[model samples]
Target: MAAAVTASMQPKSMTRAKKWDEVVENAYRFQLAGYRDEEEYRSVKKVDSAEKWDNGFVKKLQRKDGCFYYYNKARECSDKDVPKTKLYNY
Candidate 1:
């Protein structure tokens, strides 16, 4: 199970996000909740998808320890965080 999860979550390549977008926003949220990205989050939580707002922004995320983090509809990924957020390719 662990091997399969790891394999499925492995990224073919990764690059620092150059701008803020929906993808980068999700990466920030996932990292905050202690997952690499949405794929790993789903694998660990066994969920089909993360909760999202109507605008397509993440609405909530559950951490590894089972705590839930809620997000507002506003943009959470700031310009300063753009360089730190990683964009992964499968």
Candidate 2:
């Protein structure tokens, strides 16, 4: 049985990443930023993860394992001050 299962395993023709992989990667970055941004703009707009996360990695960020990015990519983003908005305050 083990031999039969091993024999059935064949490599796929598309095992390597395609040139378009970069496009999906770019989309993933955009989606993550948009998701964080919409937190303040929920009344004005919505950023849909399904419509934006073209890459699998970005989508995985929602999963428990994917959260490892917090340690690996800690410098990518932060909660510092949340940036300035249009409305100024005294």
Candidate 3:
């Protein structure tokens, strides 16, 4: 019985230690098209959160269509002519 309790508590402790990553990934995925499908969003959220550690924070991109995209600003395209890039070039 004590072993069962210890095993259950271990998972919860691990989850608490990694909650931040889950939040960031969820927000990121939502910004991306990954959340477009209701069912897929739910599943993706779970898997993504598990893979990302608490230190992993996803950056969001401001899209031209008034929506957000999931991308790291450092790696994003800087060309102004890029239609899918951010509306504001500078």
lDDT of each: 0.87, 0.28, 0.33
Error of 1 at 85 (Å): 0.3
Please provide, for model 2 over 1-90, each residue's C-alpha lDDT reduced to its tens digit, 9 standing for 90 to 100.
123223223222212213333333433333354322222222223234422232333432332122322112212223231222111111
Indicate the residue-level lDDT of 57 in model 1: 84
Query: Number of the top candidate by TM-score?
Result: 1
**lDDT (10s digit) by residue, model 3, range 16-69:** 112223333444344354332222333433333322223444454333244555
Residue 53's lDDT in candidate 3: 29
Predicted structure 3: lDDT: 0.33
- Listed per candidate, the RMSD to the true structure in angstroms reads 1.7, 18.1, 15.6
Instruction: State the displacement of the C-alpha of residue 47, model 3, in Å, after optimal TM-score superposition.
Output: 3.6
lDDT leader:
1
- The clash number for model 3 is 0
Regions more than 4 Å wrong, model 2: 1-20, 35-90
TM-scores vs. true structure, each candidate: 0.91, 0.19, 0.21
Residue 30 error, candidate 2, Å: 0.2
Candidate 1 lDDT, 33-56, residue by residue in tens: 888888988898889999999998
Ranking the candidates on lDDT from highest down gives 1, 3, 2
